[model samples]
Target: MTLNIVFMGTPDFAVPSLAELLSNGFNVVRVYTQPPRKSGRGQKLAKSPVHQFAELMGVPVETPESFRKPSVIDDLEALNVDVACVVAYGQILPQRALDAPKEGCLNLHGSLLPRWRGAAPIQRAIMSGDEKTGVQIIQMAKGLDTGDILLSETVPIQPTDTAGTLSERMSRTGAGLWPRALAALSRGGLTPTPQEGEPTYAHKIDKAEARLNWTRPAKTLDCHIRGLAPFPGAWCEMDGERLKIHLAEPSQGDGKPGEVLNDALLIACGDGALRLKTVQPAGKPKMSAEDFLRGTPVGKGTILT
Candidate 1:
């Protein structure tokens, strides 16, 4: 039997799970997403990725600012959905709305519970130099990501993995795990287990945090650079201009922190050195270190702050 689903999501990360549910013949009655907000250089209103996808799928969509309103809760209850699936919905759900569905709410969180259990799990995992991270399907509670796990799947953190790449992989993995979770839920066989171990909160990454600290160990700096790549990129100041480091790796070398070691874009850190592979100069497109060097020479012995 097809389960009646009310999907709550907003960003691109949530699109795959919504698509999977529809493709698998689940009866998705309605979608709830965050309202369109001003974005980009023009500051024009922009619809969320999930909102655009939901429109294409011909699903009725609601962009509610909050679920605290009695009418909103009443409307949700009117749908009488069997289950509510939430993925990066960008808002704290109210208990009234959570109780609207017969089976309670389920969330597909980006990280394993009790660890990196907050807004920026994927980025935090890589930034902390974790060896592994995974996704968790949980029975949602009112607390922030404090929920019992219904299902989970681990994914390794590769040496070259960035936040963007890791999030893409996790999205697919979580989408694949959904069918199994729904099957178990339908049969009343899905077990909810309490999350174990000490919890580490994954706070939202600020743009200011992307500034590279040359005083840190090379390996730690490498992780920091990779973790924030492709957005709010890890950057350093050179010739009074910001140079965002898109790719870098720890290498053998030592000198005063932030000192350029060679012509290959190697910069000494507190412990070792970092070999910058790709970079983006302020107001310029990303380019290889070699390409960047050709145009703007950063000779050896130059200090980068």
Candidate 2:
């Protein structure tokens, strides 16, 4: 018998897994995503990527503010699906919802278990300078990301990879695991194993952490910049304004930390320097360093506070 599936997710990261399931002819009866929220310059209400995708596929979508309500749990129980596939659903599900499905919930997480076991795993892995990170599907438990892993695959963290770039890759690659996991599920052959080793939390990124501390080593700063790239960017004070760095690479240079080394956007760090490749000036669109400098010339010898 085909498993009747319900998918729960929000944001772009979750789209591929849902897509994979549908592509493999899984009977996805419904989808649950976070409520649409106001965003962008106009503050227009924007549907989450998962919500938009589900709607296009003609899957029913629910956007309950919280599953704390008995009705929400009741509604899920009424669906009575075989399994709930969750990926970045953005809420801690109560135990009642977990019991709604016959086989319980399975979460597709962005990091290897026992390594990064909380929110923001992909960003945290890059920020921690890990050479490898992977996606894992785990049997959901009450605790956060503390479930037994069912399937996992490691992916390399390239030197020049930003959080955005890595996420795109992980999403597509991780999608393939859904079919395998479900096949294992239908045959009652899933062998979930408890996570081993010490656990680490990937705490959500705070905007305060985005402030660049030039006193840190160039390598550290490089990682920091890439980890938070393309959103909540790592920034520095430039002539009393914030200059967000979207991309940079460690380079050879030596001077007082935060000193402008040359015209190529090379800024000295505690150990070395970073050549800023992409940046966004305050109140301006993101642009190449060359384009940014063309409009706002930051002369050498000036310190970036």
In each prediction, how many residue pairs overlap at the backbone (N, C-alpha, C within less than 3 A)? 0, 0
For residue 202, model 2's alpha carbon misses the true position, in angstroms, by: 0.3
**Best-fitting candidate, measured by TM-score?**
2
lDDT of 2: 0.94
- Give TM per candidate: 0.98, 0.99
- List model 2 lDDT by residue over 100-192, tens digit each: 899999999999888988888999999999999999999999898999999999999999999999999999888989999999999999998
Q: lDDT at 180 for candidate 2?
A: 92
Off by over 4 Å in 1: none
| Deviation from truth (RMSD, Å), model 2 | 0.8
Model 2 has how many clashing residue pairs? 0
**lDDT, each prediction:** 0.93, 0.94
Q: All predictions: root-mean-square deviation over Cα?
A: 0.9, 0.8
